[model samples]
Target: MADIVEVRNKQVIFKDYINGYATGSDMVVTSDATIRLELPKNDDSLILTKNIYLSCDPYMRNRMNRTMEGNYIDSFTPGSPIVGYGVSRVLESSHPKFKKGDLIWGLVGWEEYSLIKDTRTFIKIQVTDVPLSCYTGILGMTGLTAYVGFHEICSPKKGETVFVSSASGAVGQIVGQLAKLFGCYVVGSAGSKAKVDLLKNKFGFDDAFNYKEEQDLNAALKRYFPNGIDMYFDNVGGKMLDEVLRNMRVHGRIAACGMISQYNLDKPQGNYNLLMLIMKRIRMEGFLVFDYYHSYPKFLEMILPLIHEGKITYVEDIVIGLENAPAALIGLFNGTNVGKQVVAITNE
Candidate 1:
């Protein structure tokens, strides 16, 4: 029998259920935990994995809340390591589908090593031409969310005017690019001039603006979409959604992908312009990415070629070490990350 190997696992523990915005101090990183780098006896379904790269996304803020009453996903336990999407290499596995040395991406704990029992959601990495880190953002959940939201939900048409909020971020960036590629007139809004430039110049958005500099968001939308918006890919909900409701054209479609602006608030902001939906015959729909996992293979087929052909662009803001994961995650709320925020645990 092979001698068992034991390794120390560093984990980012959630200090407590947060009441307001989360800070770096809210999570405590400890190196005291140790685990055997092999599957346990009698556990045929367990997979022991060494997490390689972790994704820090805006949706994670909701899981930090004490109660996830109406949320689709469960809240993170206060004393345990937080969990999110990540790429991992299997160290040991008793499962029939996965073996030692297999690379996969799915939900993983915020730790150096994780003992995963459920492999249903995990996906094997088949494409090697792109960086493995892209599995965390562009080629993973973020990419699928953009594809499903725009292609499936919005039902975009050629020559349509599409506007994406938070357009320099992970999902938004892809949405804007797809819209531009689909022959739609695409415009985007970001928080900073740098992000604005990235959306316009890097992502090929027809136009882009800094939302922070705009005193009146309604006027900003009008300046970009003088006629009216045919479709709106909303990322920041709150006031932006309210302003967008008034600018939507008749029979316009709105894909509510995320509401990052209202995630940390004690009481979420309400949209008062909802009446416009009825008046303008607009269809505003909210969707969860979990509902569309079945279409991932279809998404992969479309995106992989675009990536290889240099028809699309993906940017990642990666921080070295798992210890810096907390800061990288918190940076999302303030627009500190220019693109997809990723944490690299180890290259091995």
Candidate 2:
């Protein structure tokens, strides 16, 4: 017999396939029966782990919709626990690659305890100097997304004029800082005054503006980049991207990371100025972070030193308890989370 604890596990479940903008009500928190530390009889193919922290990302919004066509990633099944990238500790392992007491980060069920069969998805943490929660943000997918998308896709040059949208979010902040380190004149656009201030003061952006306050995003971009933008790290699609396309300089590069602005729409807003891409001979490409996993080791080698030297700073908005997971997940669509949103399930 295995020892069992009465785990008060609170989990967020997808009510149904979502349509249009995601809402807090789209997900509900429910409790499950207590779980044991050991696997069941004849079950030697699973890894039991306790989730430590859960990440809330904009990409998750796409997983909520049923009709969305690009089956590149499977949609979360309804009535089941929603899943996302998280940091966890192995409690029991049946797999050879993972052992008990290993701290890892990867795709995890939204519940407190997850019995994962595909153990290969998990990445064991080799560095413990940084906060463990960083695996959900800067040191994890978000950081790699910014690094690969900027360096690999955009191919930035020193002294070039760069513009970033949603510039104060997890990936955006890092992208702006990296551009600055490469000696680019970087400007960013955020949703609020506080985030704009953070872009300028904390992230070392040349200039930043509250896009919500700007009557015209095109004029704002033009005002900030008088000579025109050489590189655009686009996060918010729709109007912002449309304006950016119009303002791009010849041979400019655009790395389309995410389109948070259009994620919730029934029909994604289409760009009206795409002709500018052809006229300016611009290069635009979209990417998923997982595609760049091969380069993760090199990315860590470059970013870890910057983090230790304080050249890069990461911000997290942590919500405690699994009970708060639904609210925290929903906050991403509403732009309510100030930094990288995460749910801290346990102190350890």
The prediction achieving the highest lDDT against the true structure is 1
Candidate 2 local distance difference test against the native: 0.88
Q: In model 1, where is the ten-residue run with the lowest total lDDT?
A: 1-10
User: lDDT per prediction?
Assistant: 0.94, 0.88
lDDT, model 1, position 48: 88
lDDT of 1: 0.94
Deviation in angstroms for 278 in model 2? 0.9
Q: Give candidates' CA RMSD values in order.
A: 1.0, 1.4
TM-score of every model versus the real structure = 0.98, 0.97
Looking at candidate 2, what is the lDDT of residue 109? 83
